[model samples]
Target: MSKKNKKHEPHEEHNDESWLLPYSDLMTLLLALFIVLYGMSTLDAKKFEELSQAFNAALTGGVSVLDQSTINGKTKNTPTKEQDNQNTSTLTAQNMTQLQKRNELRKQEEEDLEKLKKQLDQYIKQSGLTSQLATKLNQSQLLITISDNALFPSGSALVKPEASALAKALSGMLQKFPDYEILISGHTDNVPIDNDQFASNWDLSFARARNFMEILLQNNKLDPKMFSPIGYGEYHPVADNNTEVGRAKNRRVEISIIRKYQDPDSQVTITP
Candidate 1:
């Protein structure tokens, strides 16, 4: 008598999905961290800022790391475009000011040299030395040319007794410009000469230059340290050696007052 056997029912299974939610979140955070590290490795500030904003919006929907005054605990100060342009303008103004000052100095130098040339021309005219002496002013120097007969005898390096007056006059004028460098150069004709006093034209020319330079130094006002003597021998002739008149012109001495400040844009006219 009793009841029938109770029917048996199987238990229902339920899968756990709570762990997958956290796993997906961990993967997204890892991807964001990697992107931030890669951006830090590059030097481009603009690109780094763009990456920071993107990650910030995707992760926190708030201010970026760069906006918080730091990235990876280090602050960066990037100069604005206006600041760079201002620096460039300052440098350009400084350069223009320097150029204007230099041009003014050059103009004053030209006036001073021209005045000295006029004085020399007046003296030459009064002394009747136009045939023996000449003066020229150019960008590089103020040059004075003197014939060989004006300072030395034929083949002799000795300064003539009468030429002492000319040297004295030149030294007196040079005393006005004490800071200038003076070059006293001598030249000779191509004719070869072998004598007891000099073995070649080079020796004779150098001796003549030295003797003349010594006479100039006798004034004591001129600085001996500023003076230099050079001999070109038979080379660097201004005239042909084939003719007597040309050879006479070739055998000469030159005094050059070198310029202290040179203009790079100016054309240099070299005198023989």
Candidate 2:
């Protein structure tokens, strides 16, 4: 074939790869969109933030919108100083109310005790037993002291026949204060006694208290569980043991009505 007449074969047409760039970009955008949709469906702010951070780091290496939104939400939810003050004020008011209620209850208890004391004093005066019997009201208790000679013979635990009336009257008065704890205590002089019925002052004193308490319990209105008996033999004396008069004062029985509500700050002692 002559050179001028030779046919040139057309180069194979290049594949149209120009469309590949846009197609790849479209695929990437679609993947990102699906990921965002899946994260939103979870409804977890923390997970969403982490996913946004990872995606942003991979794409542009910058902070994500999700992270900034979460931070702003936390700041807005934080309690303010004014709100804190309001909460403290509420607690203080509640505490003050409780304290006021306690104070009122204590005052009412004191008034009730005073009324009972006055009634007892009046009874003592009317019975002409002022010399042998004495009453004193203090913060801890209302004490009624009776000389041993009035209730029993010398160095004896048995109550005199005539003293029965006194026990009945006292029991009747005590019935009015049903909730009060009654303590019947016996005391003796320093002189010791050894006899057939009692081995020592301790035995005599305890027997005397028991006998007296039994008389008080004869009244059906008095609760036996509320009463207790104690013996202080030649001890816990209110007077000196050196003189006869002091010995007489030491040999006595005491009935104490203990207070139910006591003030922690106040201690009062009143002489009978």
The global C-alpha lDDT for each of the candidates, from Candidate 1 onward, is 0.85, 0.84
> Mind sharing the TM-score for model 2?
0.68
lDDT of 2: 0.84
lDDT of each residue in 177-203, candidate 2, tens digit only: 899888888999999796788888888
Q: Identify the leading candidate in terms of TM-score.
A: 1
Each prediction's TM-score versus the true structure:
0.73, 0.68
Residues 34-150, model 1: lDDT tens digits: 877777876366667777888788789898656655544545565556777998999999999998999888888788788888988998999999999999998788999999999
Least well predicted 10-residue stretch by lDDT in candidate 2: 69-78
What residue pairs are clashing in model 2?
Answer: none
Show model 1 residue runs off by greater than 4 Å: 1-79, 265-270
